[model samples]
Target: MRTMLVADDDPHIRSLLRQVLTGEGYQVLEAADGLEARERLEAAPVDLAILDVMMPGLDGLELCRIIRDTYDIPIILLTARQQLSDKEQGFLQGTDDYVTKPFEPEELLFRIKALFRRYDVPSLDKIRIGRVLIDRRNYEITAGDETLLLPVKEFELLAQLAQYPGRLFSRSELIERVWGLDYEGDDRTVDVHIKRLRQRFAEHDGSFRIRTIRGIGYKLEAGNA
Candidate 1:
């Protein structure tokens, strides 16, 4: 079953969303605040997210931006603020849909289904460039007949660079985008992961190459993607 997350500080709202979403055959993950929601996001792949706008910790708009930056999941914002400006800001942050407070459960369900209909692309999980293949859903990499499982951090870093091939991501931008800004470690952590990735790809005789841009970070150069 596909997973859905509801990040709302109110117990009643969370319970209501969970019960209804579970009844519709989705596995619902609940978070009382934005931090927990982000933890859950890092831990697994969620198909969709329903976020309450006025939560403690990181508010929904910010959370939406973070999710958009890292994950491919669709997001729907739950808010009591009905102002046009508020809705515009939410959209500017990359939310797919918005549901104001005191919303009908059926309406939310309909929106969720509509998103599935729109973005449920079959190839969203897989990336192939020449002899290399990365499956984001299964966390598996295929090089010819040999298949390898990559650690979560390494896999995410590779996927991020591969998705935006030729884009030069700075070290700081990569750290904040791939590993979250809360990471206290120095920017060299990205260098470590990149070194590990390069070693692994060499062992597998991968076709695509991740090239370092001197002072800039890295970019993926696929020969015949």
Candidate 2:
């Protein structure tokens, strides 16, 4: 059976979600706050999580980041705030969907079904190599407690290599896939970005390193992180 985790500080809301989801033939997991949710999340195979934005400890956004950095699971935020900025922040933190509070149970159920159709939720979003997490979805590189944000092109370049660890990509292919034809610089530009990316990861003490394939391109290799 498909599993869904419902996390909220309020018992009534949790009960409501459990009732709604359970009736729809989903096995429901319950957590009172983000911390408890994380504990439960780490212990089980949860298909999806519905999280309240405000919670004791971690909070929903922080929990969402951790989940995105390590798991393939899809997330939906349950919040009272309807502001566009708040929703945008949730998305940047790696949440896939959002439903404001006081929403109809049936509508929420429909949204969950739609997300399942859109995303291959079982497919991993972030690639973990030892202590470092290469998060392609959010353009985030996280190692332990530290998280680094990279420029779009640099992030895409890193993500491209991460998608197929140890696979070689020629400089031309990297430019075409990451920089695109719109890029005005020569192949040296790829080397320049690679150097900068390496330096940035070094500063963050990442466990993985990008290895040059001599005359070919580059690949991600995990050393003593």
Candidate 3:
């Protein structure tokens, strides 16, 4: 049975999440705070984590950073603060999604399912094409002697393309895979990210190219011999 760890100080929130996730056929593990959550995580591995941002000790943001740095588990940060900066902080800390408090249970469930689907898909943690080396877990991409820290979305998109060199992905497909299938956004989002990635590669002597097929999508060129 797949396990999910819920870390929140609120009794009602924990109970509600436990009930909902249990009904969805997940083995639910509950923690009262970030400290307890860490203990639970260390005791055993879980497939995913749902963390509250305002815990008494360690807090959700700090916990998310610890989990991300130590493990590859997907995390959803729950916060009462709905500011864009809050969401950006969670993303920078390696959270897969940010859920505001007072959110619909169904929405949370949907996000969890989306994360599961993505996690089950095959991915490459370390991909090397020519001089560029991508460590997806560390969120670092290196070309030649220069190492760059990529924004969350850029790293994920690049990793997806690097996973299958020379394979084409439609803009819609890339958006679905990297940004979640339920993401409601313009295809221009993909284009903008690709543009940024190209700039990063160019800074390192243009070691590799991400090919754009007109009206199609994008592909990472195979490494030259």
Candidate 4:
């Protein structure tokens, strides 16, 4: 199920959106302000965010910018302003769409659906495992305060494994997925890349680990699990 974060200061607005969003089969996470929204995002992965522009303790536009820098989720800004300049600012802050206040719930729903369709490409998404973020959009990994870019093959390998944490993937299956089925190569190539990933993330061992299944293949395990 897709998860959505609703960050708005008004209780009535949050309750209304919750009802509408939940009725559509989406899991909803609520926050009274931008700070709580950020905390919710860090605690759990969300597919999209809906932020209210007039929120206290961190307005929507600033929070939108922070989310753009860290995550690859679509954002829709809700505001009372109808000025063209206001809409432009939201777009510049990385919002995918906007809905002015006194708007119909149906209109907001349509905008959300449109944004999801636009970002349906996997390359525009991100996979988060524990503290590690595999950002296919930028081909970067953010672990705590440090960000690193891996080689194409290495990044692909990790991203694939992280996509299904704790799911076993045989060497042949991995090669076909990451290296492509047409490429003829030794299965040990998988081992080499896995080794490099482990070495590269040795310091962040508490976050996640790549486990070798000995005779079978490998699987990624979240440290907390």
On lDDT, the candidate that comes out on top is 4
Put down candidate 1 lDDT per residue, 159-207, tens digits, no spaces: 8877755445678777876899799999999999999999988854447
Candidate 1 has which clashing residue pairs, if any? none
| lDDT (tens digit, per residue) of candidate 4 on 48-154 | 99999988899999999988876667899999999999999999999999999988999999999999998775653788777888898889999978999899999
Candidate 2 versus the native: TM-score?
0.56
Best by TM-score: 4
Q: Model 2, which residues run further than 4 Å from truth?
A: 121-225
Cα lDDT of candidate 4 equals 0.88
lDDT tens per residue, model 2, 1-225: 678989899999999998999999999999998999998775555778999999998799999888887556679999999999999999999999999989999999999999888765434779887787878777788878888888998988887776655445678778887888788888888899999988887754457788776666776665566
Q: What is the lDDT of residue 200 in candidate 4?
A: 98
Q: Against the unseen true structure, what C-alpha lDDT does each candidate score?
A: 0.85, 0.82, 0.85, 0.88
Stretches of candidate 1 above 4 Å error?
A: 122-200, 203-225
Instruction: Flag clash pairs in model 4.
Output: none
lDDT of 3 at 60: 95
Instruction: Give the poorly placed runs of model 4, Cα more than 4 Å off.
Output: 124-157, 160-196, 200-225
- Evaluated against the true structure, the overall lDDT of model 2 is 0.82
Provide the lowest-lDDT 10-residue window in model 1.
161-170
Error of 2 at 200 (Å): 34
lDDT by residue for model 3 (1-225), tens: 678999999999999999999999999999999999998876654779999999998899999998876566679999999899889999998999999989999999999999989978867679987888999878998888889898999999989887766555778778888999789888999999999988877755445688887887887775462
| Quality of model 3 by C-alpha lDDT | 0.85
Local lDDT at 197 for model 2: 88
Question: Which wins on TM-score, candidate 3 or candidate 4?
Answer: 4
